[model samples]
Target: MLLSDLSLSRRLERAERDSNARFVEARAAVSPDVGAGWIDVGGTYAMFDGVESPCTQTFGFGLFTAPSSGDLDTIERFYAQRSAPVFHEVSPIADPAHLELLASRGYRPIEFTSVLYRSLDGDLAIAAPADSVARPFQGRVRIVDADEVERWAQTSAAGWSDVPGVGPFLVDLMRVAAVRPDARLFLAEIGGRAVAAGALTIDDGVALLAGASTIPDARHRGAQLALLSARLAYASQHGCDLAMMGALPGSGSQRNAERNGFRIAYTRTKWQLSAGTRA
Candidate 1:
């Protein structure tokens, strides 16, 4: 990662933060339990959705910013106040002071995800599997409709079966994305069946590519690449300078994203609050 792209790096971090906040806020519109308003924990922004189904990392805590060491106890109390875990991400661009404070308070690293980006200066290659040479998913990346929200949520949930009970949250989030300014929800389909879903969130000319998911039967096909190509084209057409996404580093998902032109900017670490610090 180039140090000169600090602006891009920070935006990428905020892209993750702001989009998720939007989801939590948007989700509240469709379901009371899914989206609660956001709050700031010390210096970090906290998204509250009230659901205990999955990790609260995405919805509750902002990355790259940490509470002051003096406020560490207070933040822990805040999470404890809600009976929520003190989960948040620490990225390369985050304030070093934050990580130091987290470490002192017994936070343990739990997850790692690579932040990737590519300039949208030109057209992207739509790479598909050879056996599926018919290119069935091409021209199938359409903007999602409100009625298709459930389908989008279903595909996302099934795509990540390891994380149970997240379908409703994902669906409600997309429902809000459909109407938000500069936010676009997309899906790829064949024969009227939705095969994949992705979201484009543009901020200050940088488009954040998120919520990419494909069903089990649709795996190994170019559904994702097709969605990528469509989103890239759409973002570029709308004057976004670059596009960004995240994936687990060294995982096949990272390789796929790299093949599609995204390069790692940095990998952020998700830290879990140790039980000892609950209150």
Candidate 2:
């Protein structure tokens, strides 16, 4: 495979594994009044919900493609019973029919994102901020430990407030990080106060970066660079040959990934269908 394709595959693999792990963690924490189900319908799979409010269940294919009518109906039913908003994650390779299906049912197209990848096999380097921005950040980066889970979760919530399902989503993320040594959470501290946080999940030969955020007050202060530098270095030393991150369309996060050596391999869109909507 080409380097970029290899990187993308590795990234998708890491995402799938981490997502599955997150689901298991979330299921374990499900409230007594909530219910959850995992369904595999041929090529399409879904994490279904009989859950409480403020939680979302996702439906999509393991490998992006069009679903058969029967498979689509299964997906529809899975969401219908829950009465909650349902989301479908679509990659560039998603079947055109799937998009048509969602549109016909009023499942508006929401966010568009680019998947970026960087090959670590070569001499991968990231530029440091100017001395003015870099000097004050020295020795201020630290990894989030058990005691800092709540703080990290709060930081994530504040950073991703516009994203749906964030509160429960981040709580579940931190819960997994708490027990998984392979999951690294890095924070940038300024004057002994944590101001930014990011996470790295290493699986196979790929290291996927996720949940990167900096406090509004901390922007342009080298906090993000510090966290990224720390994670990349750690990944390199541990034998990872690729780094990947998802970028929201036209967002600064996308710009940062490009500036740091990651190249856009492909774009993906998230399609939504409400539970009660027609299939």
Candidate 3:
């Protein structure tokens, strides 16, 4: 019931479950260290950053309910009571009536995110363009720990430096993710210094490539490709049937993913709740 053709239903199932798992794992990530938690509002999962620090999705919801199900009022009350930045990811396969309902209820489109996926039947090679500008490093990547978590976080922050006020959040998320049983943080190191990083979460026969970043100093030397290859290998070994990731449409990230054999599953919208609108 998700995509126009039933041929994609299984893939959509993977994507939906992968997306749902994030909120669940994120809620668990904040449980012991921070008091924040996740709440299921009429089948939708909501996450709140527990420590309340400026870093981190700190608070938001995903895996939205169908508008035809008549849960609009419940969803509205859930966000109306939260008092934090409310966000929703509406998939391209989502019911247009549902989107209409959300828009009618004051949700405004803010951003576009493309979900890409690739089957994990092995054979994922790093994207190495002959005209690559960055220097090829003599370093290797591995699962990280110790001070490496901090380094991974710093690299991620640098990768996303263009975003204002994202450093702290990336740091906290990486720190927490490093300890999650479902999560694995991978780092590419050259000369014993962590340069590029990516995060993977495995659950229910699928792995989500949650985040990938490299510092400006290590942009082009195939760091992300390395991360992707490694993560895919690990996921396949760990029984992950499919691997998925999200990126900005028309961005370099999207191009990189496509070059690595990831197919476009869909483009989704991140909708924000407009001010002064009643549920």
Candidate 4:
């Protein structure tokens, strides 16, 4: 469905849920240094934990999976650690009561984002590169070897200001991509210089479009479009039916997703709790 055709609220809700599920699954599978816990209150469940990153640590509560208020105190104590945690909350859990409770306990909202999704069941037509641009680079992009994987990481770091741990994170992503041949990375280049990069991962019928970025000098040069087109084409060739991405709050990434035929699926909030405070 076209992003412009959906209701903002409906789109936000859908996007957020899909994004949260993807996070829970991906992080749980690959993150070995972090801790994960699920609180079950009758039939309902809430998953909360601390995810460690280099610059900032994240404490997330998957509202849909969260147990009950009666278990909140216990869960809180369990997650309180030495490091200051950034709390994350998604929609449906951002009710007034929950907000107030967070505020009363010193939790503050930091960032918000609208999730986006695209259907891959039908043909996706992307405009061809201009005559001046290289056509060989336009075809299905894939990271088939270790050298390309390292290059992808380096290009990603260069695009994102060399954020701490990014290199390691991309390396980890490549580790997964290596075993899964169906997973691929796309780079947009001109005259043999890599200007943009993105990746497509197909898992359990879901195609996640991730790590899309363009170097500062390459912005507005159609690099994003080229990377995205390559990813969609690769996905289509591999039988993926849906494309998903988690966009940061109020960023150009969100706008770009909209322009690329992605509709807002939902909004997700991040919650932080100390690991040491749980008792």
Candidate 5:
């Protein structure tokens, strides 16, 4: 049983931070024009995928120790050098002093995420969709091979194309995710047609579950549940002890995670340097 304490925060924060670091590396490798990169400040990861990319942020701060005023200055300079806005995904369990420093730096809260976790024990359960499928079809999930990276990216992009904006950005990000080192892209199919896509990456015995999306047409099917079960099974087989993901508080994703036995580890805040203070 993992306690929701600093120890747990370290594992979860490290897992996510490393995942984004790998993503930045992958983006640079696949599309150098994007100028993707990252650096380690104190113990935090400062990543730059692009000026407008959500991957442009810092992670894992206050995990090993609190970030000093100088550390924040260095981090701000890292982003300033790239002409990008500064953002930090801060866990609630982070040292109080870190929050104080952020306040002093004129950062303001802009987003909230419910970080969730579930231990991977024996015989994991595969859930069925909340609503029965409109059409009867068998669901299957499998990890894509290297040759299918583009296919995986396309399927994942198709899943999010309906979002009001960020379609093009997500398309590129999905492409980068598909090729990240040590990352596994999974696809769910029904009647020989791919309907959903997701990604799994592990770091220090913890698995980060992300990029989950089902194409608009396949919404009522069991593709997501199948993908979730398959990813969990793979994580367990590969020696992961804990699995985690973040979702907007009170969103369908959070409810779905809760139904799958994941409990809220903490509510994290995404702090951004106020527009007036940006370099």
Candidate 6:
């Protein structure tokens, strides 16, 4: 019975912030030529993976500490120097003045994410998929061994192959993620063939679930549910008190999170600097 108050928001946001920062650190360690980097500003983490990498952004802004104008200036400069757009995933529980300041500086809301959480007070019962097609999932989930990093990354990228673009980028990104020290990569296999993948990162007693993907041929076969159950169990065994994730509002991911006992803690907005503002 955890309350969705500011304290909870801080824990959830910090868990995710630390996870993203770890990816940045891992990327830098694995490929320093890519210029992967991150900095902490007034309790906020500003990361720069690439000009177009989704990892390029800020987190925990105005949450741990009220962000001042000078703080914003430094964060903006950090990204500008890297030729990346400034983006901030802002939680609703953050200082209200933060939004006003962002808007005043020409930052516009570009995306929204429903942050969800569920307590891990005891052994979590694995929830069956809602649809009959995915019930009694016939797959098994297991953590990847050190030698299987490439296979894990390939399985993760295969899940996104249908997209018109971004396949190669995802392959590289997942490869880096597979080696992230803070992350545990899980693979769902049916008949001994990997079909799905997901990642879990625990920080300060909170587990952040992310990188969920199922190959096109593997959908509706219960792979995701198997992965979810495995990840949750792993988190609980690791002494995490809660698990959190984010999904687009009204999306199937959100529905799945809800079906698995997660509740919306807040809807966070991702603000991006307008082109004019950047100029």
Best by lDDT: 6
Q: How many residue pairs clash in each candidate?
A: 0, 0, 4, 34, 0, 0
- Model 5, span 70-185: residue lDDT tens: 78888889888889999999998988787888887899899999999999986588555475543433678999988998888889989987888867777888888988878999
CA RMSD of each candidate after superposition: 3.5, 4.1, 4.1, 5.9, 1.8, 1.3
Residue 116, candidate 5: Cα error in Å is: 0.6
The whole-model C-alpha lDDT of candidate 5 against the native structure comes to 0.88
- Ranked candidates, highest lDDT first: 6, 5, 1, 3, 2, 4
TM-scores for candidates 1 onward, in order: 0.83, 0.77, 0.81, 0.64, 0.95, 0.97
Off by over 4 Å in 5: 129-137
Q: Which clashing pairs does model 3 show?
A: 36-50, 49-58, 55-169, 56-169
Model 4: residues with Cα > 4 Å off, grouped in runs = 1-63, 70-78, 81-86, 93-106, 127-140, 162-183, 274-279
How many Å off is the CA of 262 in candidate 6?
Answer: 0.3
What is candidate 1's CA lDDT for residue 63?
39
The reply for model 6, stretches above 4 Å from the true place, is: none
Model 6 scores worst on lDDT over the 10 consecutive residues at 126-135
Backbone clash tally (model 6): 0
Candidate 3, backbone clash total: 4
User: Candidate 1 on 1-279: residue-level lDDT in tens?
Assistant: 234255666677676677767766665676665436566654355556663633245322323444565455555665666677777776766666666777777888988889888877766775553344545554377887767666776666556654677656665444555655556878888778887888888877788888788877777667887888889998999988778887888987678778777788888888888887653
Location of the lowest summed lDDT over 10 successive residues in candidate 4? 53-62
Runs of candidate 2 with Cα error greater than 4 angstroms are 1-24, 30-33, 48-66, 101-106, 128-136, 158-182, 274-276
So what's the TM-score on candidate 6? 0.97
lDDT of 2 by residue, 152-244 (tens): 767755565556766676665555444455567787887787778888877777788877877676678778888888888888988888878
